[model samples]
Target: MSKANRTLKKIKHQGGRIVPHLILITYMVIALFPILLILINSFKNRASIFNSPFSLPNAETFSLVGFETVFGRADFERYFLNSSIVTLASLLFTLLIGAAAAYALTEYKFKGSTFLSIYMAIGIMIPIRLGTVGILQLMVRFGLVNQLLSLILVYVAMNLPMTIFILSNFFQQVPVELKSAARLDGASEYQIFGLVIPLVRPALGAIGIFTMIPIWNDLWFPLILAPGTKTATITLGVQQFLGQFVSDWNAVLASLTMAMVPILILYLFFSKQMVRSITAGAIK
Candidate 1:
């Protein structure tokens, strides 16, 4: 609390902002450096990629042969559809069920509510793959193995816990007065939820992004539950292709870049919503 010490502290605080950018610059390079390398080399022929690793590709040396080969070898269209179908479907169910559960946990006071919340939340930390022994057995018994439905069901169950926890946290932050007032005006429980969840649509946006990303990127459930050659997801397909064509640098890089593009596009488009959602629920 001395004046000289206070001034020194102020200088330290002032320096902190500038200091972070150094770290940021370093981390950014660390993060995007590989991506930058991949993108630059992707356009080059193999010899140029190896010879001039850091140089950007130029028109003279650039080629699209890798992409052509990847497209030529696989049913790329089917793989894309399989991934989209599974990711979209799983995301839809996770959001719907998770939101409803989160709302109930926050809005209602009932017996066993805490226990039920805990029970559902166990999935957040425990990988559902542990239960695959049973799940696969059941799937086999039900004849669901190698089916898209199996992937969807496993993903939904795996993702539900965290989604519910996030939505519930946000639901609790919603002004209780809003719900009471809605009820005062004759809103039913269903109507209250419908009206109120939208108010926190920002949180839902965050939840949707969070839920969708993992399912889209997941290789395990798709590999285990539905690993037929014909039904491979984009992630699984790309990985398989890389293994099969390890020496085909062009095809390998193209597949990686292709997989990276969709996620990058989604994040760019939704970054505002994602950033807002993260900040909105943060406790000061």
Candidate 2:
């Protein structure tokens, strides 16, 4: 009887675990099904796309016409280059400046430091898009309306508040003794920062991924600020292409796939770092 009871309990425990796994698997499928459909249809002919949209590509249905159309119809390569430049430049500026500001707020004592921190933190509650009109007017005043530089600056400003907040939290967790010891060893503040940065690198990796995605996927600023210029980013270009190729199903799917693949690859690469940092934090 005890043996049977033990077996029943083990079964119940396993069943409980399996239920959550099943739920997670279901969510994963739901999330991925649309992307899978797009990728599957991207390689299919227009007839196949409409006729068997849910089916996988076969020998008779496989086509590269969509990709060819996208290339021929859009300056897709330039759009990608513009996006890459803006995302990378903005990411660099946000991390470097935000990290320094965070470290300063966490480390130094100054008049109005607390108020200044609060002032910066307020940007988190406010969406930068809310100031689009003012930003556009400011850009026009400086003749930066259609420039990639303007896009980069806007992204940097948009991402800075959150970056500083996250990095400041991490900086606070750094051992004051380490900084004190370094200072005792005649290390200047810059030297201490250099030492601390590598220790917080995993957190930095997490922030980089967080900051890059929004900037990469953003359509509003790019559309409003850099429309019609060669500085148009991939998201804006894809939107324009979709509008132009409304009936061209294959071209639309191909352009989407092109735009998605890079960001997907980047996310997958950094996701590990993000997960690791979170896990490490929990452990600590």
Candidate 3:
């Protein structure tokens, strides 16, 4: 090819790559804007929050009153602990059971396996919230009402279907030779499953972040199942600042800002793996 034609082709290739990155950056900015606003306003006084909602905290506007109120009026530490416990515990159980189930369905040949897979997939289609009444009754009967365990159990059940679906697809993509090699090396079934899990780390990261966000931010389940002060998740605990006639915007914003910390950490931790997974899928 001529130098001019070669240069044109190179430019075209670079533009193709740049365009997607531009789109992604635009989307990221759009998504993070609200969170940015919350964090900025959380540091400002109430008057400044209302007067210049989008502006950053300045010398005159900056105040710690919101943080003060939040810490003073509520046991935010306990709420944070409760939410962390429930969210992490739910993710742990969901991943374990879902991964095991997916491995069984994909790797094993058994009776009713197809039917069982279909039955599990049904959970993905039907919103778990639709069965709230029944779940509440079951929890009540089990004497788990107002308990963090109730939230953990419910969240695990809620997230399992999607987890299984995603993990099963990833598991299917695992090279047969890898598993065969493990078997040839005298690896037991459980050991082979362990070997497969690390290969699907990206999928696990994606599932962990996906499953965690809802469970952490969920107010409905926390409100219904574990509304007690001692068991309240951060999302529900923040509701205390919202009153019938008035709301403490400062404390509310501060609490929300603080509540977002774990999510940011999780995203930062798992973002690389998720990007790798997406890029890998796109390449294929």
Ten-residue stretch with the least lDDT total in model 2: 275-284
The TM-scores of all predictions, comma-separated, are: 0.87, 0.91, 0.81
Residues 1-49, model 1: lDDT tens digits: 9999999999999899889998999999999999878877777888888
Steric clash pairs (candidate 3): none
Candidate 3 has a TM-score of 0.81
- In angstroms, the error of model 3 at 224 is 1.0
> Which ranking of candidates, highest lDDT first?
2, 3, 1
Candidate 1, superposed: residue stretches over 4 Å from native: 1-20
How many backbone overlaps does candidate 1 show? 0
Quote the lDDT for 187 in model 3. Answer: 95
- Tell me, by TM-score, which candidate is best: 2
* Local accuracy by lDDT, each model: 0.86, 0.91, 0.88
Give lDDT tens digits, candidate 2, residues 1-284: 69999999999999999999999999999999999999999999999999989999999999999999998989988998999999999999999999999999999989999998999899898999999999999999999988999999998898889988888989988999999999999999999999999987877888887788888899999999999748889999999889989988899899989888888887787787778767876786
User: What TM-score would you give candidate 1 relative to the actual structure?
Assistant: 0.87
Q: lDDT, candidate 2, residue 37?
A: 92
> What's the alpha carbon RMSD for model 1?
3.9
Clash pairs, candidate 2, are: none
For model 3, what is the C-alpha lDDT against the true structure? 0.88
